[model samples]
Target: MKRIGILSDTHGHWDEKLETFFASCDELWHAGDIGNIQTADTIARFKPLRAVYGNIDDFKVRSAYPKVLQFRCEEVDVLMTHIGGYPNRYEREALALIKAQKPKLFICGHSHILKVIYDKKYELLHINPGAAGRSGFHQVRTAVRLTIDGANMKDMEIYELPRS
Candidate 1:
């Protein structure tokens, strides 16, 4: 089993709430808008990171960060991108991209709303950890960490960042 830390839409800040629990994860995945390479470097200090670029990401950031991430963790293939916008908006582009690859876990950002919806029609699990710190509803800034064991995942932990 591999413990993974997932966060998204952190435009530029890493909230204090995440500091303590972060280093314990086996790996980290960012849905992007990370804001700077320094952020990536910081994350690297704790564990290897897999990241995707958000719409706000610049060319420089794209050069430094992964545009898309695909890998196997705990027997499941995972695919990640910056925005997994609803079909009503992008109309199948995101779905097409993900479907073509057939990853067990599909991660994305951009909406700033947290979602963990399963698509029975496709047998896919989609995750959107929402704004980790930099942007969101302002009601709360959230993040998720979980352990993947075979086809089953456990230890789903959520943290709400302290108000800034």
Candidate 2:
């Protein structure tokens, strides 16, 4: 199995708590809103990062963030994007992507709040790591880790990391 760390909406700043959260993963998937290349450069020190361009990400950031990433890791097909579509209308967009990609795991981030939902309606699992930035909402601060096997997945358990 692959230990994957998922983070999104960093908004260009990183705190110590997120550092601890991402330490255990083999690879990290950044779901955009990175805001700057410096953030990506910092993360690269820990693990290889796969990223996508967010509305806030710019040219320098895109150089580090890919629009979409697809790869097989630990026996699972993983697809990642910063914002595949919209959260309020996730089902429709997710179904479309699911039908087209047929991936075992699909991850996205754009919402600054953590979310992990399994849509039986479309047979897709979506993960959002919330914001790991200084301007993020929610007082506790959060991030997520996903463990996967072939076509089986579980909800991402949320962890509140301290701000330092």
Candidate 3:
């Protein structure tokens, strides 16, 4: 089993609580809008990171991470992008990618709204960890933690803090 921590839309801010919450996680996934390279570096130092460059990210961040990331973790096929939208309302590029790649898990961040929905049409789990940083219009900063065991994903948890 692999413990995973997921967050997005940091816009350059990092919370001290994040370190403690993700301490036991085997990997960290950043959906996008990471804000700056330092924030990315900090997370990378804490744990293995899989990330995509967000709209607000600078050249340095874009150079380090791709606009879209598709990979496998154990038995799960995962797809991540910064502005991929959600299920039926997916962006053109994201919809095309979803049709072509057919990932078991699809993750994206942009709206800074937390969502965890199962897409029946695509047979995939969709997650948006919301805005974990102090920037943005989000009322609450949120992050997600879950366990992936083979093809099963379980024990999902959400951590929320008032945006400071």
Candidate 4:
């Protein structure tokens, strides 16, 4: 089993709380808007990082990460992007990608709102881990952790810190 920690919209900020919350995770997934390459490097040094660049990211960040990432973790097919919408309100590009990839877990971060929803139409779990940086309008910084064992995703937890 691999433990995964997920976050998004860091906007160049990194919190010590994340180190404590994600210490046990085997990997870290950043949805996007990472702000800069320095932050990305820091996170990569902490744990294996899988990331996509968000709209706000600059050339350096975009060069370091893909716009969309699709891969398998254990037995689960996962798709990640920075601007993908949730459920029925998916963005056009994301919707097309979802239909093509048919991932079991679809993750995106752009709205700065935390959401967890199951899309029955596509049979996938969608997660938006909110904004983990101080630059956003979000009142609380949030992240998610879960265990992905084989095809099962369980033991989900949320870590929230009041924005300072």
Q: What lDDT would each prediction earn against the true structure? A: 0.77, 0.73, 0.94, 0.95
lDDT at position 45, candidate 1:
73
TM-score per prediction, in order, is: 0.89, 0.84, 0.98, 0.99
lDDT: worst 10-residue window of model 3: 12-21
Q: Please give, for residues 2-103, the per-residue lDDT of candidate 3 as tens digits.
A: 999999998998767998889889999999999999999988988999999999999999999999999998899999999988878999999999999999
Stretches of candidate 3 above 4 Å error? Answer: none
Residue-level lDDT for 50 in candidate 4: 97
Ranking by lDDT: 4, 3, 1, 2
Lowest summed lDDT window (length 10), candidate 2: 85-94
Candidate 4, residues 1-164: lDDT per residue as tens digits?
Answer: 99999999999999688899999999999999999999999999999999999999999999999999999999999999999998989999999999999999999999999999989999999999998898978999999999999999999999889999
Which is better, 1 or 2, measured by lDDT?
1
Clashing pairs in 3: none
* Model 1 lDDT-worst window of ten: 85-94
Name the runs in model 2 displaced over 4 angstroms: 85-88, 91-95, 136-138, 154-156, 161-164
lDDT of 1 by residue, 1-164 (tens): 88899988888777446767676788889998887777777776767888988888778779987767888887888888887764334326577877688877888887777777776665667888888865556567777888999987778887676446
Clashes of each: 0, 0, 0, 0
Error of 2 at 1 (Å): 2.1
